[model samples]
Target: MADGILYGKPISYFPNGYPLFIALLKLIFSDALVPTILIIFNIIFQILSQYLFFKLLIKLNLNKELALITLFFVAIYPNQINYTRQILTEPISLFLLILSLLMYVSNKPFLSGITGFLAAQFRPTLIFLFPLILIHEIISKNTKKSFLLGLGVILCLFFFKILEYFNLILPPDNLKFNLIVATYSDSFNINWELARSKLSIIKNPLSVYINHLITNPLDFLEKRIISLWSLWGPFSVTHRGILEKILIGIRFPLFMFSIALFLLRKNLLSKNILIITYLPILVITFIHTMFFSQQRFTFVVEPFIIMHTVLYLYSFKGNFLNEN
Candidate 1:
């Protein structure tokens, strides 16, 4: 809640990796420069992401008109743009995830391994893609190669974790409780701690699976819309009028539409993005249980998931295309 807590001290909003990223940047530049550079970099990356997405469409054999319209929609996705500017881990992680995916689509397994390694640093959950990548290896009959690549990724991650320790970037946080404390400083929370304790409902398959289906719609909506303004809650308490409530409640319509299109896409059932997008979600929900609940936390994987929707929309030959 305090600027002093976030900027002056260690800000622990997420895992140690993102904080490590911030620390790495600060080692080379001043704080004032970090935000400015991040803002500029994000804008550039946003444009590049648009271009690459269009290129991806072209690769998938979409028409030029269709590809450009797709690009426009992605470019104007306000929630995504806000995410890009936040100096957070999601943007770069998602970018690299898309890169690895593109490389995979282009017949480059090695590059996928490399990009996935980089993306893992931005979010540990990225490792969940290993199963799918392993399947790719098996499909290619390169079992040994897949195993070794995965091993290499694990070793590299360990190397970074070790380096972080040597540099004292990831000390006490290696202990989950301390990490949570470091991630977002608050005095303490009886409610969160209680909810986190009861997260074991996930260990039971029937309950977890059933609850996931029943709660997913509301959970997804609340996590997206309500999560945003909660960050600055004390700062903006009285400002939650109807429109603000809607915005805060639902993320952005484009993002929701993107998600909708993805879920409806029949092709996704057989797509590689399933591992990168859908399965990780199940695992994450189980693991986090009741501990944390924010759309942004899950949003790290949104773009890759979004591609499925975008691709599906393309198949429809629909007229949702925006005029530029």
Candidate 2:
């Protein structure tokens, strides 16, 4: 409300996905209604996303009963609903991601590609989902179709960048800034003093970052790994109070239990629905390992986490989770 919608340069520096959506609402309606409408729409979108996710679980051959259980957990999930009230990308990004996955599983590759492209615009890390989808297609022996879909998705992502290159859009170049900040800490807090001091001596931000990273690769890895931990689970988002605390308490153990089951079942090594479900988690993890890591930034992948957790506890049917 204060600075208005931000984009480009010294004043505001970020992608335009979430803000553009809000801006469109503001243009259509009144500014006063944007907040209330945004919150309401986000809640609705999240519910829809959950419904899609439940169907996805069923398609993956999870027991119908367990899929409903997973839907219940997702509907009531504290971390997810927490972002609905705020003017942030998490809600919409999550919605788009689930929609994309649903489209893909339903054999609508072109639509899935479009939805995934939108999700990545909201949260850049989600762009990694395309490669995972490509891998899934390869494994499913649909390489030609995956290639075309991926190409379309890539073109969508590069469209804006190409426009910017031609001086069409002026979104701020935040990559250098992100790299510079990464040298300090995994947290989003920018050490301006340190950054400014370093900038004073450096001619090129990218060069300095590359040199530092080359010299201290271990330190870079350590900070990113710790950041990923903070971003993934209960630590990432703020809890409301006692009720949320209880939910996290329940969720955490289930999460841990699921992880154990995932490994014991060798879900990653197997060529099945488990691998398809698991690959996105790895893709997002690797994306954060390289970019600015945060809870809200990676919220797009929460459904996958919740799905696997519930699946593990329920144990659908056969020895294999994937009926395909």
Candidate 3:
């Protein structure tokens, strides 16, 4: 930030929105105060995320009590709370995504697109959702208006890439880097040392990545499945006590059951609007699984997951316990 502000250099390695957010804070407060302020800001977003999540549940036809139960889960979810302490984009981006969904569900496509675009700036993986939205719009024959809304998102993302192309900001190479790591990292039987050495010397890592996929198709597919499993798998925190483990274990089966019910019973994409709204989850899941596997990267979709899960559990009434 100092280098960018002082030397007028474009910072590109990460998305410009988040670093600029930090820079603005640094301008107002000292370096020591910045982390504190950022964390506070993240906490505020976390609260807002839960609030909007409650609204989303209501929009989904869930009763207020059921919505409140979902909100409780959002508030207490360890992973959701854990990320807020760190000065990362997930908290804010997650909040923005929920807000975007709210707007979309409320029939404000332009505003939803704008908010979603901002969220994408914070986390570029979100750009994948826009294309899915576009596909939905076309399939539903929403015509130029819907197409334009989707185009707005594409334009916002393209603006950033254009800036990168001109060296106006940092290069957005994280996706490429992650792809290289996913292909050649130790998970695929290539040790980090060797992978790092190869990547370090490669002039065109993407080409090599493509070649690896061509020659080792099974490895690529296997790694993506492993990534998906990790994303939705049991919640395990390192160095936690037995009680924590037990709680997570208890939640795991219920969570899985909820997901199963959602996939089998819920017509999430049945409506045209819903198709455009929630298609991002499927698109993002595939992209994240293919290129990266961090739980944090998939955090934006958790509120919906929790909401559906809670709704399913609540529907069972006492039967959920009786059967168990």
Candidate 4:
């Protein structure tokens, strides 16, 4: 279905206007190898992305081995593998998203804007980060120039949203944001989130922020007790029973390592990219899981989650790290 719309003569399954840049190229070439070529280009992007991530990781004082391990995990993440073959937005979105973080960390605020704006093409939802990043700029005591560039980035997103609204050009769907999930959730526990929002307004806000930080998860566990352990393996879909799926859910836990690194290495501020990358995802998923769906909503965080999972593996020497 995705391939046909991308390669065949029709619209895509979802409103993936962002990928049309590649699609139009495929259309112009009119070759059966279009998808192959697209994937190949993404492969190049993957390599460059590794280098970029490594550069940032190194700058942040992480061990090189940790950086490599992180890159490895991101490379093989299963959901990414299953999705990249078609016109889906996940692959490119992952690339641009990470690039934005790398750019931000390297002190190249303008490039971050460009990369982040490009990311909006993959997932317009990133515009949500503007307020947060502005908070970062203010907290960091950035130069006025940096602050302006940050606003420029937000304006860039606004421009894209306008383009999408007019149908003049299709950036990703800014309007596609799930308001029900972002604002209110169906989950039984609202205590932490309610506290997080309130504390953002108070003096000495670190405690509440820390509490929110401690609980934020970037995992993709299926909500089934059975599937959680088997989540990434071939066995996930094999168990068809409702009760079994529920069992699988509990097994899926988030990458739960950022705080450990923050503490063990005393790297709380240096690892801001990791923090920035995961927090919005946590908030978004918390709402959606409560109000709309289940743990699979974790896919929103898949790209960064994979990156961290990759990094975490290097903590121990393993056979998995030796593969191509």
Best-fitting candidate, scored by lDDT: 3
**Best model per TM-score:** 3
Candidate 4 TM-score over all chains jointly: 0.59
- Model 1, residue 22: C-alpha shift (Å): 2.4
Model 3 misplaced stretches (Cα beyond 4 Å): 1-6, 154-168, 186-197, 235-255, 267-278, 317-324
Give RMSD (Å) of candidate 2 vs. truth: 4.2
Candidate 4 deviant stretches above 4 angstroms: 1-19, 31-33, 143-146, 158-167, 170-254, 258-274, 283-324
The C-alpha RMSD of each candidate to the native structure, in angstroms, is 8.4, 4.2, 4.7, 10.9
Instruction: Please report, in order, the local distance difference test score of every candidate based on alpha carbons.
Output: 0.53, 0.67, 0.68, 0.51
Candidate 1 deviant stretches above 4 angstroms: 1-16, 60-63, 144-148, 161-168, 171-241, 244-291, 304-324
* TM-score of each model, in listed order: 0.62, 0.80, 0.82, 0.59
| Number of clashes recorded per candidate | 8, 0, 2, 25
lDDT (Cα, tens digit) per residue for candidate 1, span 1-324: 113223445433345555565666676788788888777766776666666666555555556775676566556554576678787776777677667656656656566677777776676666667556677678879766676666656666676677555544432222244223222222222245643454433244345434554677565334333334332122223344666455444434434554565567545334544544455445444333333334455554444334545555665665433333
lDDT of 3 at 312: 60
Ranked by lDDT, top first: 3, 2, 1, 4
Candidate 4, overall lDDT? 0.51
Query: Model 1 Cα displacement at 54 (Å)?
Result: 2.9
